[model samples]
Target chain A: MKTKALLFASAFVAVAASLPAMAQQTATSPTLDAIKARGFLQCGANGNVAGFGLPNAQGVWAGLDVDVCRAVAAAIFGDATKVRYTALTAQQRFTALQSGEVDLLVRNTTWTLSRDTSLGLEFTGVNFYDGQGFMVKKSLNVKSAKELNGATICVQPGTTTELNLADYFRANNIRFTPVVIEREEENVAAYLAGRCDAYTTDISGLASVRASRTPVPADHVILPEVISKEPLGPSVRHGDARWGDIVRWVHYAMLEAEESGITSANVDSLMTSTNPNTQRVLGVTGGMGAMLGLDNKWAYNIIKQVGNYAESFERNITPLGIERGVNNLWTKGGLMYSPPIR
Target chain B: MANANAAAMDAAGGIGESKLMAWVRANLFSSWANTALTLVVFYVVAKAVFFFGSWGIFNAVWIGTSAECRAAKGVGACWALFPEKWRFILFATYPFDEQWRPALSSAIFIGLYFFSAMRANWNLRLPIAWIAGLGTISVLMWGGVLGLSFVPQERWGGLVLTLILSTFGLALAFPLAILLALGRRSHMPVIKSMCVVYIELIRGVPLISLLFMASVMFPLFLPEGVSIDKLLRAQIAIIMFAGAYLAEVVRGGLQALPKGQYEAADALGLSYWQATMMIVLPQALRLVIPPMVNTFIGLFKDTSLVLIIGLLDILNAAKVAVADPQWRGFGPEAYFGVSLIYFVFCFAMSKYSQRIEVELNRNKHR
Candidate 1:
């Protein structure tokens, strides 16, 4: 046994000698180059959360998050068809992004300080600004989150919601028992099956869950308490700030398109417009895309292919019954102001 | 004396082939085509082994993530992530000062496993010894007294947590399974039906569903103000699930018992319980000891599924550790390392089972 242990240790040491050289492999960002060569973007998404990211009965992936991946694929390649989706759990998301197993995370992940700074990730932009809320059965007669004191709550574990729930309860000095599951959809089912008294997550998620209810959502009520700020967004690794900036601005261009009234329907007409801002955005003006090694009509192609931010939201979120509340344009008394194109 | 006759049959001034070469010639190189195929098989296997050894041993990273790993360089492995997160990967979310409890518990569990596996120690007092030992380990691990602070099972994780789940699961299931298997073959219809219902119901459902039921529906069945930790609930679900399968294994041994043994015991005027306990069960249990060890290896691997219920066993712990921003892209190495640990355990037990099987057959022949 001693002889074997010595042999094993020596073998370990011999293997350990090469690790230092491997560790110095030079921090190069090869993701963009890989995507360019493959002519497609490999995007990771939530597998089966309705309206956020879900696979259809036919096994094709489809959702608002899935659409964001399509939009990125369209922006990179000329066609939105050049996209591959990798399904991921909440616990698996950051690791997937960090490992370069997926080019970017388009899952409905809540942007938080710990995840942003500590996880070596940067939130590109807020695609959906949401808030933590709860949904309970109507028979419970629970009208608000405050009334949920002493109630048993079903929650998805290993997420931003877990921390937010802890913080909310600790702050309010209200105690509630938690029944945790790793998968969100399972927790939703368990909640409805009377195993748990309430289900807690982001407000948009509640609406999506309600919309897909088998017996209709009227049996349940979403309480009016917005417990914590949830900025749902896409994130890329921090290895390449240049690539991060490009992804961030892709989202920024969509918000700017809505602000400047550049609808997908009239994007062609606006491309030929005389307005300095439109000219600058559409290629007749400043060389914005040229700075990033892309063409000046890059933003135009994005808008033409996928529409603006508000359009994406209105087409996806509005139909799921998520009102504009804080997601509306700045002129409509909301907070979606963007940096000017000029 | 037969040399002349053998030389005559050889016909070509030789007895066809030497003894050593004759065996190989017949078995491996019977024809020209067979010789070619054998050489090809040997060459391919050697080449495959050489390639794997070069990739896994020669070029792999063993420690420290450098700029190369950040850029994803090594052709073999990126083990710098394990170096950066060695602690968290070994003990998830556990407080720094109290990690010794889990470490100590793991040592105790390993020692117990070794002791219990020896046939010499397989006595009536061993179960009692196991209960006392495990009880002490749990208290020491979750100490709220004796100047050691309390740590909840939810906070307990990593390799030790996996060990605990498998150990406790076996402790709970094995004896219960034996009794159940016996009851299933009982003369009384009521007890037989009860055992059959239990085994069938548990065997029918998926383990994941049972885990879900434990995590969610279990608390509802209790009166108000009663609560159970999520970890304990998952443990109970695993034990019950294993018990049903183990009951079938024990029943196979019972069925293998000869009818003559039952008749001889009955002819001695012994009661049914006495016949079973004193005469049948011992020989039957000894017959099935080999398969029972295989069940243990299966249980050891199945413990990983507990991660779905939110307990941070080895797989989940390694996941949480690699997800640490400091050790970016460390999934391949950490996952591979943990998988090696699992392979070593299950492989060793399976091999031991094979050895004991041969020994048991040898003894039976004697």
Candidate 2:
């Protein structure tokens, strides 16, 4: 029995050791090439998150993260519909990307240093800037997070949300008990049942829960303070720089289009714009797409098919009642900025 | 009534006592301790029945939108969720207009089971029927040949996918399981050790790990520009996992057979394969029917684990159904419906196993 156990352990270690080496075998854009050969992009997505990634009742995939994949698909195939979605749980998302099962993972995964550097993944660009916040009943009469000194909070375990809750409370020198639950639904139930005084998670999640989970949406108010930086984005395996570049540029193209007053409806007229930047981005005056080994009209395809960043955002996120706060373009005093297409 | 009572009393002299009172006296009020315990249990059960009855049936909203569901929240079950999302829960992302294909396919599966269940159909005809039934189901599901629109395997989900995974997994695993069981007991050391290693290695790991390897790792092992269908990979994993566990159950039955049976076959000068096929296997298989069916029921429910790998089985479909922002917070209604479906399938398997156990054990009972 002991020998058998040893054999299992060693076999596991050997497989684990060989996987990283295998993942590094290809240096060129093999993933992009394979996706082209396959005729459709395989997108790893979140199955249930409302504004980030989800399929509607008719099984149509829609959301901000979903749009990111569509944008990439549009850039490559010139057809945004040529993408197949694979719903991935949070735990399986990174490994699914690393193992080459998915061409791109736009699954509301937070961009963190450890995940980006150590996990052999590259975060292309932030699609949604999320931050941890708290939600409390309006009946509590608490105006701010600092007022809840002795309250018990319900949070999902093993998440940055729980860590942020602890850190934020300790930094304020306040005392609060935590009700750690494993699933989101249970945490929402505990909060609604008055088992805890507050529920803490990402601001978008708090908004989602308040809008949907609560019996009365107006009764729960999300706290004003955000405790952590969660820049959710699209990612690809690290070694495929060309594929990574394509994804990064696709996201940037959306932002740049939004910045350039380009909407999907107006993109055709803008194709004849006299401004050099607009001309270059619209593929009327530059060979930028050739540099990426794609058609000169790659950005044009993305903007035409998947829309600009704001269009995608308003269509997907605004329905969840999330405001375009820090996610707005830099010209509008937000962090969304794009490098020059020229 | 009075005349009849008088006539009965005249015909047979009897004490004036009610049958209900007599039963209560014998059962509930047999002794001091019994009467007290029965009253307590009855009170608790009655209260529970009242609570669930009001919550689930009486006050429940049968048909309405999410607004009505929200209005009845906490006070009653939102049964309206089923009316709204039943199609999504059962057929999942299969094209809405083309849902009748899956519906028909599921009916055919149940029909095939019904046909195969009869004792009279236990022959070559059974296998032939299964082949035809499954072929028709496949044609219906993936229909480009029959003037029906083509629905790819990726769009398949919900109860149909669950039935597909469990039924096909078990059907394919059963023969492989028997082979492994026989190989484990074979005199050839190489074959025996190989079978032992295969079973042990597979049985040692959790099904989730095997599924993870299939979903994530298998693609990496394939050469560049080549990929297998995710559903097929998960199906293979389930088959391998069920095969290992089923092999051990079969081995239990094989070991239980007496040495005298083998000796008797040997004295008859029959070859090993012939004796094993004609004499040993039938009895051994009969002895293991209960445990074998127990494993089948387990594997059937374990198909839900495919949800973790992103395949939408019925349970996952229910979850996705409730995940719609408009219908969020109605998980209990969706899950209750899902549980009923699972219970029906698993319960049928258990009852069928009991029936076969009794049928096969008739001679022993005599």
Candidate 3:
């Protein structure tokens, strides 16, 4: 009887030890499965950033970051509207994604080495190549960021921008007073109320804050200098390589579509063209979509429904009078480049 | 003739004054000191009213874009933004086409609230009415049946989400609080200690911490692949937090009850449950009506804290509204609009609670 019980216990331990490996093989990417089962993509977004993810007067979310989520949804479900946005603050965005509260976080979160390694998150790619910049009143006559020596600058605490500010000032051998605030709005309000001579944040943030929060847009000027690299992107939990691949390729596909001039308006005409590259991207020639465990027409659906990277940029970012300087395609001498679909 | 003339003069200037003059005297200028103070206050108040009225009403830009608002700068409030963005502020990210569902649900909730406030509705039918009302609201908001389009709980926002969190939180908390109150007073040492620990632990933390735990930490404790909706998690946190405070209020009521009531029920051969339900709870609950309503009001306002965890309550929706590039820099107007809505709801609750308190205490001797 003792030998029989010991044999049963040994069998149980053997099965239990191999259970995780079997589970991993069966459900390769639970995030993708949950998303498909739910019939919509749960996207975390910045609720307050104007040109990034704020909602419109009609209660529809429209912005560059929002477009990335929409493109992902279009790629997965072939419907851009098949997405629910959870507006998360900077403090809550990571935990929301990590806890599976949101499938993808496309908030204007700066991708840093620490976040990538320690936060159990994988940043797909830089959707918006942002950089830290300074904004000051036009009346201040500070044409260059270097001119603001001994000035009181309002900045949000616990952000990469704060670190960048200190580094830039020390490098230039300039002295300045730091007026640290907790919230983005408070920093802007402090700047507008003349409590600070300048406000430092991402250039896109400066444009949005000036365009949306300033009483007069012409009153504020974003400085010409780009101090620190802030590559904002979509992120998913680590270990979901399939989900990460889908998000990464969705961005790449958009950029490739832009470089190839295959816009949403002309995707149908281009789909039937004799061009092998277009055929491959439209899924008539290659199995790129299948490699990501998606349908052949996934990239095609993304362009057809949510448009390319340029279209999203023009639609959401251009209204703030922001020129797509470094965000332009590689063909136009910008850094935006995509791997060929074939 | 001289006396009559003196009376006529008095009526115009002194003792037997006209009604309007008497009112002015009583309210504004009874004495020289009062007259001087009233005049100074009136001057300051009138100047403020004039400036505000001119800016908000007379010289305000009523219909235009942000460019137009800027053109009218230093003149008045940008009233045009309100009409353009009121829906976003009120319904938030609810699908534009399906906004009517949230609108209808809010109406039903308000109707039920007012119905429940009336003393005449305080009976068995009240609970039945509440159940029916809440069920209809759930069907309307969730919308997986009755041929209505399905709306998930995450899409719910603005005033509708606020009312749901508060109403449902209070509804679930009330009974749990009653049980906790009884448990804390129970003869069983284990039950009493458990109840005491729960109350103290929850009450020791702020609502924001509880919400943060619900949003961030709670999922870590759950097994993998099992998840709760963000709104539901916040609602649960609200219920738990409210239950602790409500339990204390209920305990206050239970402690105030006379010992003879328990003895009387025992003499009548009543069981513990029966004695508590029939003889103890009704009287104790009535005694704590004011405090109980005060707790409900606090819970209603505290529901706004869910926005910290990304649930779009009315206040958060207001922030989103002004964040729009089209209506930017209209923070004051947007906040004022939201505060008005909150004031209306909270004011109604305050008045109702006051009325209930009076009604409950009307027959009391002291």
Which has the higher lDDT value, candidate number 2 or candidate number 3?
Answer: 2
True lDDT of residue A25, candidate 2 = 38
Model 3, residue pairs in steric clash: none
| Residue B308, model 2, lDDT | 86
User: What TM-score applies to chain A of candidate 3?
Assistant: 0.87
lDDT of 3 at B88: 81
Tens-digit lDDT string for candidate 1 (A133-173): 99999999988788878999999888878989989998988
Q: Encode model 2's per-residue lDDT on B1-366: one tens digit a residue.
A: 999998999656434456667878999999999989999999999999998999999999998888888989989999998877888888887888999999999999999989989989999999999999999999999999969988877778888999999998999999999999999999999999999999999999999999998986676556433568889999999999999999999999999999999999999999999999988999899999999999999999999999988898999999998888888888988999999999998999999999989998999989
Cα RMSDs of all predictions?
24.5, 5.5, 5.9
Which ranges of candidate 3 are over 4 A from the true structure? A1-30, A213-219, B1-44, B259-269
Fraction of native contacts (fnat) of each candidate: 0.00, 0.42, 0.69
Taking chain A of model 1 alone, its TM-score versus the true chain A equals 0.81
Clashing pairs in 1: A23-B66, A23-B67, A24-B68, A25-B68, A26-B67, A26-B68
Q: Model 1: per-residue lDDT, tens digit, B179-298?
A: 899999998999999999999999999888898677544543443223466678889999999999899999999999999999999999999889988999888887897789888988
Per-prediction TM-score:
0.52, 0.90, 0.89
